[model samples]
Target: MEKTPLEDWIAYKIGIRPGSLSREAIEQYQLARIRQTVALAKEKSTFYREKLSGVNPIKIMDYVQFSKLPFTYPQDIKENPLRFVCVSPKDIDRIVTLQSSGTTGEPKRLFFTKEDQELTIDFFNHGMRNLVGPSDRVLILLPWQLPGSVGDLLRIGLKRLKACPLPYGIVQDPEAAIAAAVESGANAIVGIPTQVLGMARHRKGKELAGRIKSVLLSTDYVPQAICQVLKEQWGCKVFNHYGMTEMGLGGGVQCSDLLAYHLREADLYFEIVDPETGQLLPEGELGEIVFTTLTRQGMPLIRYRTGDVSRFIPENCPCGTILRSMEVVKQRISGKTILAETDFLITELDEVLFSINGILDYQSTLALTGGKDCLTIEVKTERKNKIDPVAMRQVLHTIPAIQQGLERGTLEVIVGESCEFMPISKGTAKRMILDTREQQQRPSGIQHS
Candidate 1:
């Protein structure tokens, strides 16, 4: 195993001395590892062998050539998952089956060895160190029933660092979650963004206003409105974590500087590409995120298209770590829309809706009505009947961009006590904007909000 230390604090956990190599040396090391991974996958996995048939791993040499290798799409995994596995069934330590949110597709299964699980645990341990301390009692709000589930893995990491972990599972009851945190003396909380926001708005959630010191929002997109609310209401520093089940659970975490994510470059290679053309995009250009596992042994995904959209932030972080940063990831390609010659993203709608005082949840849909393009947004409010047209307009006035969309007749507002059109469950993928103007076929089985 080859290693290059990027930070002093990270050196001990990742097994590399701090600043031992220059930027050039680190790239060289990564390229070498990439070659090794390609060769190993080609040798052990029939899928990789056929996909990378003519490509000579050793002669490929650079990133450009590496980029020439065929991409592995989600459909390939969906159709022939077993062919991608490099290890025997007996050696697989854990298997995570994730259902697609579309409500009509088969689940994607992710395999991991014990060593692979440890790598993710190592990532959690080091990543938690950025937002927590040895004395801090952290509250994990995800499920922990399975042996290698997210919360269970995180608990193991926190225990390894001498930090107390209070695993309360998912936030089924916001009041109860708050009570557990208060009783356990929790200083930090981790969970999905919506659940965390729901907890923050609860009357009891406000009771922990000054008690909790930090929050880590994950799973779905973390809206600016939610981030602002969490910071103001809880008086805590908010951080974002970007990860997926296929990436062995832990991928990247934001540093204390709160710029962008400091990627787990040691375990995975990240790239951005044109969603339609599949060509590599320059830094700062919006595109699909592609990843290749450099150290994963159970099943090394080569150039797997993640479908999540984001860009690489080229600047060095003020946090002083050489590890690269990525722009905050937003909704998948299916959730993006161009309404009446104006663009609308789920994140933008979230910012507009969630910032309002009475709004609890919202959903936007684009449709063709009477030869006109119309965007109908349904907002669920905390005050129920109190959310009349006058109150709704006042709240909508806060966002100037949305106001422009309204004036142009591209946006329409519908305020209600409860929005039946929107799926409010915390378990499914959160897709706030649904563009029904076109036969909007959602990605496989993932549902839209």
Candidate 2:
């Protein structure tokens, strides 16, 4: 019955955040909480009990000792999910689950207690408070699949925001969804970028552009071009959010892409490390992002290696928010290409190309012959036939590094599927970079300790 660390931090004297303190104070407090967490999990949770049979958490002051316990991956829970439960079903308040599926294999299981769900709502509400005010109405456009948590809690938070939420899990036709949002008299829209982009390009949303206030792009990777087109046609601000069911609604934005995300740090500790070494990488190093939840009663990921690769900003947000800043990752590490000579981080390529407004949507794949790698780039455009090949190539091929790599045949750009892109997978849709490295590496991996 001990109070959760997250609840304590949020309900602290300021009733704002533990992050309001100076950097030195926050780290000192964090280390103390880490000690408390390790002790609590080890004492109450059998999984962590076996994990720390001998080592003392006090001795392992930082992440090094924390990670040494074992790499707690999704598969460990999937194989023995019931064993992961620290409490019985009678004590459990709520349960949330997701597929623990691996690549071309059986899906794994995920669970959440009521505490976990509320924390998720808190962050989602905190994130939404940025876009909405008292007068707005929201239309949530989600896949509405079995693990309905994504749209579920978002609806709850929107309700808490004093906004009307019309949750639509069915969008069999993207074009029709566009028309519905226009006619629903809703002021705001939230859905995947792919489906929303299809609507934005359609003539209907363009016709009803003046009525909307903000368009939220969620549950997928958003191409900048789609954001631009939506902003232009819909005449509303297009906002991007990064979150997952396991982590709760984790991240939100700061008006401009240049400003890194205002991370919900008190709930989760954000660490960007050398992807290979697991050593804490310095700020600005594009490293793998691993997380530890300070207070998740259901399924606390202690040093859980989230398969995404991103970097951390060494300072607080410029918008006067005390929450830490993280560059919501542009590329996942699994998408990188390691040829016989050079390794290409596709995220850097995305930064260069997505900044240009000419292209609408793109998918990058790595083709390997022995050790050589050629990139197959597919682009979706509204005006594909009208595009200037020479002028377009000059703009695309002129980028100093990408062009050099293209000349060496290590990089190739080819466009495919010029119209709207259908959903590829259940979770967030990556740019579809086919890295034929091991066929095992994904944005999130299923490694068991």
TM-score of 1: 0.89
Q: Considering every candidate listed, which one attains the maximal lDDT?
A: 1
Count steric clashes of candidate 2.
4
Per-residue C-alpha lDDT of model 2 across residues 198-260, encoded as one tens digit per residue? 566654556558877788777524556667777887788877766665566564444433356
**Measured by TM-score, how close is model 2 to the native structure?**
0.78
Candidate 2 stretches with Cα past 4 Å from truth are 1-29, 58-70, 74-79, 90-106, 144-148, 219-221, 251-258, 339-342, 345-406, 409-414, 418-421, 436-449
Per-candidate RMSD, Å: 4.7, 6.6
Q: Please provide, for model 1 over 1-449, each residue's C-alpha lDDT reduced to its tens digit, 9 standing for 90 to 100.
A: 11212244344434566665345655676788799899989998989999988977899789998988899987888877888888999999998777776635787777899999999888888788888878799999888778888899999999988899998887766778888888999999998777788788776778889998999987646887888999999999998888888888877888888768878877888999999999999888989999998889988998999888988988878766777788888777766667545556777778767876656667666665544555566776534563566766676655555567677765565544562334444433546566665554334433333
Per-candidate local distance difference test: 0.77, 0.62
What would you estimate as the lDDT of candidate 1?
0.77
